[model samples]
Target: MKWVTYDAGSGPRTGILDGPTVRGLGAGVTLLSLLGDDGERLAEAGAAARTAPTEVRPLDEVRLLAPIPRPPSIRDGLCFLDHLRGCYRAMGRGGELHPAWSQTPAFYFGNPAAVVGPYDDVPIAPGCELFDFELEIGAVIGRGGRDLHPDTAEEHIVGYTFYNDWTARDHQLRDMAQGIGMGKAKDSAITLGPALVTADELEPYRSDGRLHLEVSATVNGREVSRGTLAAMDWTFGELLAYLSRGTDLLPGDVIGSGTVPGGCLLEHVDTPDMAGFSGWLRPGDVVSLQGPALGHTRQTVRPAPPMIPLRTGC
Candidate 1:
């Protein structure tokens, strides 16, 4: 079942997607709360939503928010090394993978407060010139655990959703140049929604323990990049294991599989004969992403809001 948080004239409510229709769940039954008790409650809620006949509405009639709009936290992992290779090539740098990459799944914490609905407008980070979008798949944590084993981490994942890791390339490179971090660059916005497809529903595509879904991105209805989920160097289970090594995992915590190969504009910029690419995004550009299992959503780019002046020469 595809679980979602939507508003149909009665405030945000939990709903289950059944084709082009949405069935509202019991009041106060949120997707995050269903992650408790090792998914026992989620199972009950799914069953109840299926049988309840009231509150049924067309999918397009409701406003969709991120399944877990504001998860407790988010950890985005660089599981696709090819994406790094492409970036390095564009930057005139070496394309060799760091040896440590094989030993660990590197990840960075994201701003949960910046999370936005899948279809909401995306504002250009103030002062940002080169904006990009990362096409990724996000796994939602269901059961909390510490130092979980990769083989057993599967028990903790409740569902999957499309993740659009919007980026301000100029801001990121500037921060990384200082050898410090990439927070302010990425904290602008991260899109999640359509619906969180329950893990069981996607089992058929699981191969060698990794989900293999074809993912693609489009700008103003033109396809920009495409790749498969199976291309990741590590599985979601492995990522969970690595992230949980030092702390406890919590329900509603999101795990993002970083940009797929050729999944963002930065990787394509400066390529041979790069026409139709404006080098960066402009206001009114619509960006969208999706996979076969995941529903599609689009957001138009909006000019950044007024910037806060910094204290200078104090």
Candidate 2:
């Protein structure tokens, strides 16, 4: 079943998306709350909710919000070798893949407070001239667990959603030069939405031994990047297991699949066809990311505010 969180004049509420209309499950109910409950029971309740006579709202009449507006935690993983190689080469680092990448999955913690909805405006980072987007898929954790094995990690996932990992290239490079990690560069803004597709709904696509989902991004209605989830070097189960090592993962926690090959502008700016394109996102530019089972997330770029300087005290 497809689940959505939207506001219909009252407040954020949970609903099941049926065609172009959204059937309300309950007032004040949220995706996070549903995820915290038994997965089987939640599915049963959702199935019943879809058939019962309830308040139904047209999709256009409501404002869609992030499935879990404030997720418990956000972890983004770098699981695409093609994207990594391109980025390293573009940044003047060698194109050779890191040896550790083949043996282990790597990820970074993103700020949950910066999460935004599908149609929200993304403000350009102040003093940042090179803003970019990373097209990704996010797995939402259902059951909390620690020291989870790879074989059992899939049981902890409830559903998946589209993720747009916004980036300020300038700030990110500066942070890398100073060895300060992602810091403010990545924590500024991230979008996740449209709807969350449950694991059961996506089981058919898993027959190929990999998640066979197509991912693509468009800027101002012009398609730019494309890749497949099958390109991921690491699977979601592996990343989840790695994250659970000596750590506890709770319900409502989100883990991202990272950027697919050619998913970001930084990787394509030097290509022959894209050589004339400007690498930075401009105000009023709308970026839409779409996938097969997972729905689409569209974000409009808003003008940047005046840069706030860091105060240096004596």
In order of appearance, the predictions have TM-scores of 0.96, 0.95
Could you give candidate 2's per-residue lDDT for residues 144-245 as a string of tens digits?
A: 888888876978999888999999998898888888568768978889888888888888888656778887999887778888878889888888999999
Model 2 poorest ten-residue lDDT run: 270-279
lDDT of 1 by residue, 201-304 (tens): 99988888778888899998878889988999888889999899989999999999999998888888887635866667789999999788887779999999
Full-model lDDT for every candidate: 0.88, 0.86
Best by TM-score: 1
Q: Mark the 10 consecutive residues where model 1 has the least summed lDDT.
A: 305-314
lDDT of 1 at 306: 77
Q: Which whole-number lDDT from 0 to 100 does residue 119 have in model 2?
A: 90
